[model samples]
Target chain A: MSDNAAPIQLFAKKARVYPKRVWGTFRKLKWASMVVLLGIYYLAPFLRWDRGPHAPDQAILIDMPARRAYFFFIEIWPQEVYYLTGILILAAVALFFVTSLFGRVWCGYACPQTVWTDLFVWVERIVQGDRVKRMRLAEARWGFEKIWKMALTHSLWLVIGLLTGGAWVFYFNDAPTLLEQIIHFDVPWGVMSWVLALTFSTYLMAGFAREQVCMYMCPYSRFQSAMFDKDTLIIGYDEKRGEPRGKYKKGDSWDDRGHCIDCTACVQVCPTGIDIREGLQMECIACGLCVDACDGIMDKLGLPRGLIRYDTTHNQEAREAGLKERSHLMRPRTVYYTAIITLVGAVMLFGLMNRAPVELHVLYDRNPLFVKLSDGRIRNGYDVKILNKAHEDKVYSLSVKGLENVEIRVQGAGEIKADQLHVYADSVGHFRVFVVADKPADARENVDFRLEEVGGANAADYDGVFMSGKP
Target chain B: MSKNNEIDKVSGVETTGHTWDGIKELNNPAPRWWLIVFYITVIWSIGYWVVYPAWPTLSGDGERGGTQGTMGWTQYDQLKEQQAEIRARKSAYLERFENASFAEIRSDEELYAFAVAGGAAAFKDNCATCHGTGGAGSAGYPNLNDDDWLWGGDVESIHETIRVGIRSPHEETRLSEMPPFGDMLSGEEIADVADHVLALSGRAEDSEAGAQVFADNCASCHGDNGLGDSALGAPNLADAIWFYGSEKGDIMSQVRKPKHGVMPTWEARLDANTIRQLAIYVHSLGGGEE
Candidate 1:
């Protein structure tokens, strides 16, 4: 012990925050982003795209049982999962690009936590009243007025949470059909459980957790400084001009005094309730409502606006040093991130454009590698599987090469009428093909088989081995 | 130990009677809810020990090994219950398959689906040994999922073949024999006929010379284009599917000393309903004909 200190306190009770509502440029931007993002989330599942009678028609769907993912006109089979990885990489690099230029702008404006919490707070304000009234009501004794307002506010929040959860399940199933099934209580128990879980989490996150999710739960907020640079824009106070804060008088001399009036308007309007004059803090969401509050007071006082503003640290330092503003946006980090994002996007687009419409897989019989007929001919059996990715049935003609005098026999696929094989649309056709060669050179030889569409340009080939070894 | 009971400077909490390098630990109590969760887990573990098979017995008897819980829960018992539930669920399909006629079953899509599912299970359990897992038959056995059946390829014929078996000891087995041709024809004659059969499938270089030999020695059972008669259980030598093999040496050996394979009568081993299921399953393997 130092012998001059008091006993330690391990815990401190949380001070309830009642941020006074304010409007500005950032507030309008945030409101616009929330509307656009939430609108897309709730309505995208209902958007329909006409896939033929054999496939789902949803514009964006994850058809689990069919093992297919449909995005508008593009259908992705199970084998095409790498496209999702490409998308994730693109999104991550794009986020890095945006963050390097704008700092925690995404966290303040478009994060789901911020948007849902804003909606919940707005609902609470409508049911109750403004900040002072809400604070008073919280401290007041239980009454019918308080009880009704609290109940109404919570019920509205729950309704929003329910809709949020309900919209999520529609992406996995046909939206209109699932809605009908859900209303009639015919939905599966597993689907119902997912809906309930999502509903509870949304309600808990938006209603009561509020800013705690951004501060304590979200990992992005913890590592946000890594993306920030001296030139990156952030919400900051002009300490050089506004410091030595004090209340102003009408006949003040304007000598040996800073411009700040110390009205605490900026602190009062802060969503995370941190004093901006204390420099930047991790809890500050940089939403810029404080800037609007300060600007309003400055206008009233006949002073220049922007006592709090969105500005870069380097620009602020240069201005204080009486130098012209200069920005360095073409940094090495941003250039590399941009290049990687472009490369990934281009590669994925190229892959999607070049994907073949037909695929061939050959499974040579493992047991009895080859059979010998009385005619001195060696035979090998193969399960030739042809996947027709087209939307309509296709007739494919089969041919074998790389071995002379090879006879192809497909069981039940009678006579090689031009060596044709019929495969249904969007399905795999399996044929037991027996390749016979009279007096095969050596015990085994590499052979190539091709399945060419009877009248179309699409074709696929597989290299297989013709075994003439003992059975 | 000298500064163990002293208070920490900054936190304003009492020391925890411990110190490490002049940094005193705080005597802070855990959150009440956290302690409640801890107590709950302690109680849950005791309850679990009482309800489930937990401890070994002192007796060390090999049979009555462990202490049985009050609930009498065992992993084997759980498995049996799960299996029983699955069987109960499938009983509806079984009842329909048992009562419906083969024609009736085939006409109803739902009944056919049930039969196919039940038949697939039976096929894997009983028929997968001889017939490859997918009915892609081995060298000696005929591939059931092909159109190259010796007797016939129709569903009815398949049912009869499965019930009576081929060359089985059963009284009504489908019996046939191609008397070893080596006794009558020379080895060179057999080789020539083999080439003629290969030429029918377009595998041989020439069939002009062997065509005369084939007609003279093999036309009675093997029809005119080397397409054998299915009515008498003779395979179509014109096709590429060779039961024994397709090699020249294999054919010469078979002509010299024909080794006929026998299939046991399934009716004697399996129930009639199961045999019916096997027939439907075999018929559904894609190569079954009308």
Candidate 2:
């Protein structure tokens, strides 16, 4: 260690960012993204899908009590949780593909944190005035105007947070019913706790945490650079043209000077408060707001636009070298990601299309595996569970194979015939089945219990073993 | 450490007393919001300690032997509350079970399902020791799943037998006994009767002498065909399901000195609804008579 080495201070006070309001193409684009994303998030639960009378009518619902997940036309059983894995994989690869091409568009436009923070900032701006006024108010002494303005801003932020948390819970329950419960203040503790937790987190994260969440808390920002290539699009400064910059007068020299007028419009409008003219840093979200701000500045100064712009490193280098820039969209990374996305999507589609309406599970009795009857026959007991996934009651005829002279008898079925088992709609029917068979040559014999839906085409088979005393 | 107290010129913030090469560490404090949240958590922890049992008492003479917070919450109390909730949920079904007869219970699908589940749980706790967990009995005990039963197999008969057990201490118990004929009948006669009993099940050759001995000694309780009557709690000798071993020696020993098995009366132990549930569960095991 160096003798003059200083002991490091681990903590640093956060520098508050007050992004000034700007009217440009990217700003409009960001507003549109926020409106559309928040609209879908807040309104998605109210969208109704008819699942007949047996299932919930919510278009997208996670019925925790029923252990079922319904997505439009598809219903997911607890046993079929692989579909969730498939959906997650698809989402991940799609994000990778988009990141490799456009660079952090998700972070800029589509992320919940960004949208909510933008909304909160918009509210703050509307209540307390824009950047300079907000800074002045923060530095000003305590007063009624400051107190009222700050209170109004926080109240609006809290209301938005409450709505956001409230909308999130509607996805897990029936929307209209839960809305009624919430109106009446009759929400269960389990649901109320989740609502409060999400409310507090949303309020804190969007209102105060803001860009600090992106800079330190978000894992995506830390690792997203791994997906970048030279051709990956990013927000950067054209240092080749912007350097040797000085303030422009009404009439300035056109020789040996850059077009940049040293106006800090880009930095003033940046949400993360990092100067884009310093070149691309990890804090840059690639939102292109800096480009919009610089373009406005260039138009005012009667100079060419794009001192800061969205460009690939390769293109920037090519432009510096006086060569034509080209884009490579078919790189191996993108190709692999696309292939995986397509394969997983196809597999999930096939599985959903061919999902069976009936499933059988058989558990052989362990204690006293085989009982000897008075007729000198051996019987094996099984607990058979039939999951009827359809919307109507179904009677399934059960039979056993791989054992000679096997007779199936169901307990508690009364006069409904020994082989016919009745299963209710969209529920599991548990039956204690006794399979009587002649003594097998081996101590344990493999048997298959075949269940065929009466008057229907669906069938399921469960493999089980029949135990007997050694002859 | 040295005390240079150098100032960083770029951001106009004071640096730490020490410097490395040309770079100095700035002494920037944490954000005010972070400090506020830290203080809030500290206050919350104090409140939590005041409301919950957070500390252990050194003295063993305390009521709880530890710090009992104002809330006075205990894991046992939580368990009891959870159990009470479950019992309240099942109270409706239990009321229906108490009011309904065996036939009515079997007819109603929900009531039948509840009975079976409750009965299976109770059976595992009480009856699974002597009878196997699945009711496949040992050599002395009878297999509940088999067609042959010493008493009766119907649900009502099973209920009555469970209430006042076979040869139990209860006054109304189903009592039957096979007398030990070792002194009355000679050794040769006992062997002959044992052979006749085995022959009734086709396990041995039928002999005239064995038939006479069986009619004289066992025919009073065991019927003429050797199919013992359920009314008398006499086991059927004609079936392959035997309470004791079916070997020639075992039959001869039983004829000489019969072993009687007693089942405890459940009326004194279980509630009426539980006894009925057990009866239904036993009857549903596949061999209950119509």
Candidate 3:
């Protein structure tokens, strides 16, 4: 907006932000969120489960070998993949719901990118002696001191990245057992490769990429406009108090001037480095670091805080008119989002509760639909798939009925148990079963292949179709 | 600790000049590194945008979108290579086994191991649901891995089980059936002999009265010693193996209520060598009779 027939500089020299640190309610909330969220991310993988001798004991695991996922007391088999669909739906709805209540809180504190980058920036400040030393060091040529600082900082970032990647594989197996394998250099090459890839990606994204992830690469940022409304509580600057921002001369007093001293501390503390006072922006993570910085400034200036704070637009405008007041947020958008969240969560939980532990699939062989025996009887072949989803081995007995002249011949069934077959826990076992009809069955006839559990724990029945020829 | 400094800080910056817990803040400039970082990050980001598929490409040629990137790398390519490697290994083993007889393959250590691995996977894919892991053979499904053979345990017989299957329609398919003993004998008599049959397997029970019952009815199919006849498809009663079950109660129940297992022939679905490998695995199951 700068003008007067002169080309504006694409870049401008600006004052550096020296946030005189302060404390208040919003700052405390941000500190709490940082602690809780980071704590969960770095620690959740270590939780344990006790799934007996045969199963992996990680409390939350995605056991690709067993083809079952475990979470505390619940285990999901491959057949129950719909639960994953339900989870994804629920997550989307929950994101919408939260955004409706407090816009971009996830961006502000909970997002993995935000959380890690915040940590990384904190580490940078600690190691390089804050903003000044880091800038001077970058501008200066490489030296022993500069090199050591860079090396130390990068090594710390790599360690955090490694930890992040290391925790991921622990979700797929027994964490302790896998850790031992990793330590002993005996892990599968795929696991090691995945670890390396994840570590590298995490380090690059959180350490170097930082806010750019949200600004450019994230699809959520582009699509999220649909979820936001005027009632959403977003980090907004009050132009009524802060603008016509100007610096007071030596003898000026508060009565004759506007509240803002134009210090730019809010701009400096921002991880995304966008000015809140300029207005709302897509780049702002809404982290409230600005609010902390500005509130500290205001306490010193003998003026009210919240020059930059979470407020709705209507309230921001009202306050600009020197009429500050609270606004209601439980409007239509919030109600709709909350309803969807509740609905999705309920459906997901219900599906998890009713999920079955066994599945049976049958494919009737078609090549030679039926063969006529010397006895003048006909036979039909069928391939049966029996999946055992229980946590222990189970033996199932299969039977066929409805056809009067039908007799079943499983290769070893007569010598074994006539109807019973056994399978290991959390596995699918296939078998070939021939249904020989003493008389011909109708073409494209379907018969029920019923499997009844005869032994072990968690006995259950599963059914599939037996295919045959024309009557 | 320094009231004069605290008062000066509050006087200009809008502070109360009143110190809280004696920690007064200085109005010093934020570190210069932070400012430099902000600009550097913006510049570096633009550079990255040019290299990776970070932005939507101007040309809709989906190479960086739906199609492969400039690197031409793809998950499909990786998967295809892995599959090709597996196929190479399998075809070599298959080539070796193709020339060998079923028995020869069974005895060959390396060949047998390869067969077992392939056969077990095939079983899991095609047979394990009914035949327990290790081919322990579930009830109503004969344990091909066991020594007790209703038809036989020879490579040809086992192959026939995997090929034409039991009671199957192949011209030379093995087929045997015993009329329900209940039809031939009274329910009471069937129960008595079922107990005696359980006793024959060295199981403990009241066999004193069951002997007469077995001599009259079961001898016809099971034969005199209850050794059974493969020709008749009756199972042997003396060797500690049971088709329906070895338990007295299970045997009695089967006698009271007859049951049968059904298996479809695999020859029509799979190739010849896979059947050979399956037979080899089953025959090598420690219980295969000569």
Assess chain B of each prediction and give its TM-score.
0.76, 0.83, 0.68
Higher-ranked by TM-score: 1 or 2 = 2
The TM-scores, one per candidate, come to: 0.74, 0.88, 0.62
Docking model 1 quality class: incorrect
Determine which window of 10 residues in candidate 2 chain A has minimal summed lDDT: A1-10
DockQ of 2: 0.32
The alpha-carbon lDDT assigned to residue B174 of candidate 2 equals: 93
For A350-389, candidate 2 gives per-residue lDDT tens digits of 9999999999999988866788888788888888899999
Q: How far is each candidate from the true structure, as Cα RMSD in Å?
A: 7.1, 5.2, 19.5
Give the Å shift of residue B39 in candidate 1: 8.3
Give native contacts recovered, as a fraction, per prediction: 0.23, 0.44, 0.00
Q: Candidate 1's residue-wise lDDT over A1-471, tens digit each?
A: 376766565765666677777777777887888899899999999998998887878999998888889888678888889898998999878878888888777878878888898888888888888788889988988999989988899899989988898899999999999999989989888788888888888899998888888778888788878888888888889998887778899888657777789988898877777898888778878788888889988888888998899888998999899999888899987899889998999998898888779999888886556655544566677888898888899999888887768788765322334267888889888776777777567677888888899889999999888887752
- By summed lDDT, which 10 consecutive residues of candidate 3 chain A come out lowest? A13-22
DockQ of each: 0.18, 0.32, 0.02
Of all true interface contacts, what fraction is found in model 3?
A: 0.00
